[model samples]
Target: MSIVVIGSLNMDMVVRTKRAPEAGETLFGQEFALSPGGKGANQAVAAARLGAEVTMIGRVGKDSFGSGLLEVMKQEQVHTGYISQSESQSTGVASIVLDEEGENRIIVVPGANVEMKPADIEALESVIRQAGIVVMQLETDLNMVEAAAAIASRHGIPVILNPAPAQPLGDELLHQVTYLTPNETEAGILAGIPVESVDDAERAARILLQKGVQHIIVTLGSKGALIVNASGSLHVPGFPVQAVDTVAAGDSFNGALAWQLTRGKTLDEAVRFANAVGALAVGKAGAIPSLPRLQEVKQFLQEAAEAEPGAQ
Candidate 1:
């Protein structure tokens, strides 16, 4: 089955610092690195590396960064036939600062990503029609995201919306989403509740459900994730790992979850698998480079199981 990712494509510039800068103040960083990372591209690469057939639908500029982004997609085996290039705009970019503790702060410049319009999604109707699942994030224009969700809904294809960099959404968009995955902070913003614990996440998820989203998964960082639906709420624990950089952990989780769901795994199984993927990603340092391959994930899971008590 094919997965379509309709989102942004950006080059990430990361700075490793001892701590984030205060307002009106600056601090020297220890190191700097550049990598292919937009929420869309990162998720697409994560899924592709985990053996999913992924198609990326976004816009990039006709620049070196754009070229490098496309090259990364090709190397990851993600289909880039639907990706467009704009002559008027530069490629999108995210400037990120990571602290010694692995926490990060980011600022994104949409650039070419904002150039994606409903027309672009309409142009890829055939690709969306053939996809088993369509994954999206907030890096692109919200109008385009809504249009894509509507189109996928009309075609009866499942849509997984990860509300990253969370913003207010309308009922029309919420009604079209089959699954809504939001991290704690995002869920808190969308639901207008404090998502500090599993109970809080459940409450936030319930608010989303009332807004017409069918299923909700609120990721709780190291604590795990909360799964909520009409049936009830369930908490899936996260895998413990030493985090080096948390740049793409959430993206990896979303991608792996989508891939597992497409493979007919239950929500519990998918979340568990996604947790492993996220754990692996945070243990590394880059965005796309941190995503684990299918074999690596399987081996990691096997090792974790063996390390558990009372294993034969």
Candidate 2:
């Protein structure tokens, strides 16, 4: 089964600061790094590295950053047939400040991402309809994401919604989602309930399910992820590692979860697999470059299982 990611592509410019800047204050950073990012691109890379036949749908600008981002996608074996170039706007960019605790604050300039229109979705509807899973993020226009979800629903193809950079979502969009995975903050924003802990996550998940979401997965940073469905909820503990960067951990989780679900794994099984993949992702440093290969995931899972017979 193939996976299609419909979203944005961006070049991330990051700085390592002691902490997030306060209002009216300027902080000096120790270093700077440029990386390949964008919720859509990161998820595509995560899925591709996990052995999925993946295709990306997004827009970039006629600039070096856009060119380099496409090249990175190609290197990850992600099909770029749906990618387009924008002459008027520059490619999307994210300016991020990462602290010593591996936490980050970001500012995004939508750029070409703001130009993604319904026509673009219609143009790629055929490829999207043939997919086993269609993953989307809020980095692009909300109407575009809604349009894609509508089409995916019509085809009976599952749509995985990762509401990153979370914003207000309409009931119609939530109802169309087969699976909704949001981090604690995003879940809090959507559910209108606190999701600061595992128990809080479970509460928020129930609220989302009541809102017509079929399934819910809340990423809890180092505490791992909470998986909730009609059956019940499960907390998947994260692996302990010294994280150099946590930028793409959530994207990796969403991608791996899609991969497992497409392979017919149950939600519980899929989340367990995804948790391992996400943990491994954070132990490394960039976004796309940090995604783990299929063999590596296998090795990590095997070793973990050997250590504990009853492990997930």
Q: Write the per-residue lDDT of candidate 2 for residues 36-77, one digit (tens) a residue.
A: 999999999999998899999999999999999999999989
* Tens digit per residue, CA lDDT, model 1, 260-289: 999999999999999999999999998988
Name every residue pair that clashes in candidate 1: none
Q: How close is every model to the real structure, measured as TM-score? A: 0.98, 0.96
Candidate 2 minimal-lDDT segment of 10 residues: 236-245
Off by over 4 Å in 1: none
User: What TM-score number comes out for model 2?
Assistant: 0.96
Top of the candidates by TM-score:
1
- Alpha-carbon lDDT of model 2: 0.90
CA RMSD per model (angstroms):
0.8, 1.8
